[model samples]
Target: MMTVTRPLTGAVVLSCALSGIAAGAPARAADVGRSATHRVLDVQARRAGLTTAAGGYPGWAKTTAPAISVRRSAAPPRLVAGAQRGIDVSRYQGNVDWAAWAATGVTWAYTKATEGTYLRNTYFASQYSGAYKQGLIRGAYHFANPATSSATAQAEYFVANGGGWTADGKTLPGMLDVENNPYGATCYGLSKTAMVAWISAFAARYKQLTSRDVVIYTNSPWWALCTGNSTAFRLSNPLWIAAWTKTLNALPGGWPTFTYWQYTDTPIDQDYFNGSYTRLQVLARNHA
Candidate 1:
């Protein structure tokens, strides 16, 4: 599940307000012992009207539905009871025929909208609006770059674009794509302590702006290596695990369960939202 990020050059990184670390730059081994200080923002910063964190729990209880299965190259695994189908795409899935895709039974879609402070996906507008126009529940995500930019700044950039939320039953909550740093070090050349603080700031700022928690997308090794195996986000941000295996292993970050599983990358980044279609609608509408 460890994917290499597209390397960013110094000029691009500087323009984006990201850390100065060059892609493939070496880091001192003693970085492990470094400490970081972060200013914690108010959890309830913006509104008395938006959905509180407690109210935002994705209702995980199963709803009755016919099982839907995907055939792997070998054979299709039996569908997990109550799981619904979806996919996530970036500019790489250029000019998607969203209607035709949805006709194949995809219920939801997450499109990459922004990365770091300035890198808006070239296809985000078309893909995001296209998915919604096709009657699919759509969400947007920001690929995190805590090394060059402060998390709050990047969160601000994400929300100002297509990543904002509404109570209308169409938009899924925004996601924080905090995995291996695409531009620099695996953990963005940061200490585990710094990485944790960066994520905290990003999540808090996202909540302040959108009044909804951002879904956390990561794999177990990245979670452990980058965030000191932090579970602080589990209660607020739903987990979207990236484990492409025959069997899922124990999840890191102390998550009791996952909300989405990205199972494949070939036919596209196919996934399962952990509930029925009706429950998916509830999750979309829950953001006040």
Candidate 2:
């Protein structure tokens, strides 16, 4: 690992090492030529020609990732043994009938809370509270806009709004949704090294504030493209992998298995916890 501190950028020190690049090297196409995902994201990134990036829309990732070349033919099993059902909700899912979802066997959920360092989920109280009322293990997520603000600042904003976690069985630790930039450059205009630093900084800050490691929600392709598949957060952050296949195919580098898998966007970003309901409670209580 390499220690990093920039002249500006609000004291977000970084210490993660990359495969083939120096910690301070400028981001370039050659730096991220590790996989097909990297190549595809690079092409789309150049084609997009975006000058800036912004917006922390919760569910925009699925739309942006299709341009990348990650089509998994094998359908992931709809039901896995010892796994619990889950879902993610946002204002777009407005006034969600949590009771309706719970009745369908949805036992866990994540609600969109904050985006970047400015916007708050307009319906967070209703959504976050409603999921718990429906007897589901629910949590909040921050849609990361790495280009719009410092990662630490965004993490602070998220916790100040709705990202805080308690030891209660019903509330899950907060999650960070880092994926393809919806409004601009694919990697938020940050070099892959800087992207790794940004995420490390955010995770560190969230843990410092909440005493819990934030769950990282991301897809494999975007992660490879933006962060160069860095393994720095694998040990500290539980992964909530967003693979829209019928089941999980290839996971991002580092994690041997996923804690949560968002399997599809249809029927509302359905997911499955890779454990039993009791284990789910363990996760919520920070005992796992």
Candidate 3:
């Protein structure tokens, strides 16, 4: 009795048929060209595995990679055309020629005052004061340590060491450098609840004393991990976001709309300061 075995009931038969088609489907001359293209692409992709995807490789990965074209909403306003443009400088500890720096179009400067509870380089006071004397718009900064057991103590230290606003009763906003610090341990250490209370208290006290809004300077990581919630801190407060590549936007998942972008820390020539300064420019036309 000739028994007809059930047709090889397995994926192996199906795979064989698919493989045959994959090989024979390119019989036409036109299909041959397409097959050649696919084969070349497959080989190249295998070689580039884990490096490139449909989005393509990054700029630095290979010199042959396509240039990345970024679309900016609008060109940043020139600092010279506006009020002024400058950078914050502190304990990086380098000699700066204020006149030479000023000549490079540096219109303002923010000097580091205190780090944690301790005062930073004593020279900043003199240098900061000198910049003001030389006619550069000047402000002061305090490196915040939110992880400190006492937020009030940290605030008090900043108030004491950072000094009062200038004689004009006008000062650039008080900056709180809230980036990574050992006390905080990590970017998110200052929880949203804690941050709101701490920032509110700090701002309230700062305004009562100096009558200027407290400007919060932090990177995207800190903002997302610590202050992404709507209830955290005052949204109206000017935000200085440290985003090296892209411009701050109102979109979610991006850096919040920042008043200032700390684009680069690498030294660049400025007009109003004595030496090379990190270049920071305002984002919007309105200073608010």
Q: Which candidate is the best by TM-score?
A: 2
Prediction 1 global C-alpha lDDT: 0.65
Which portions of model 2 show Cα errors greater than 4 Å? 1-59, 62-80
Clashing pairs in 2: 76-246, 76-247
RMSD for each model, in Å, please? Answer: 14.2, 13.4, 23.5
Q: Can you tell me which runs of candidate 1 are displaced by over 4 Å?
A: 1-80
**TM-scores of the models, in the order given:** 0.72, 0.76, 0.59
Candidate rank order under TM-score = 2, 1, 3
lDDT of each: 0.65, 0.70, 0.45
* 1-288: candidate 2 lDDT, tens digit per residue: 233332212312222223423244234332121111123334555433211122243333443333334434244324347799988876555567777778878899998887786566667898899999989999999988788789989999999999999888888889999876654567878998999999999999999999998999887767766777778887778888876555455566477567888877554668889889998999898846
lDDT of 1 by residue, 7-102 (tens): 222101101112322355333221111111112212221111111111001211111111211112233223358788888876555567777668
Count of steric clashes across candidates, in order: 4, 2, 17
Clashes of 3: 17
**TM-score of candidate 2 relative to the true fold:** 0.76
Measured with C-alpha atoms, the lDDT of residue 201 in candidate 3 is 77
Better of 2 and 3 by TM-score: 2
Worst 10 residues of 1 by lDDT: 48-57
lDDT of 2 at 153: 97
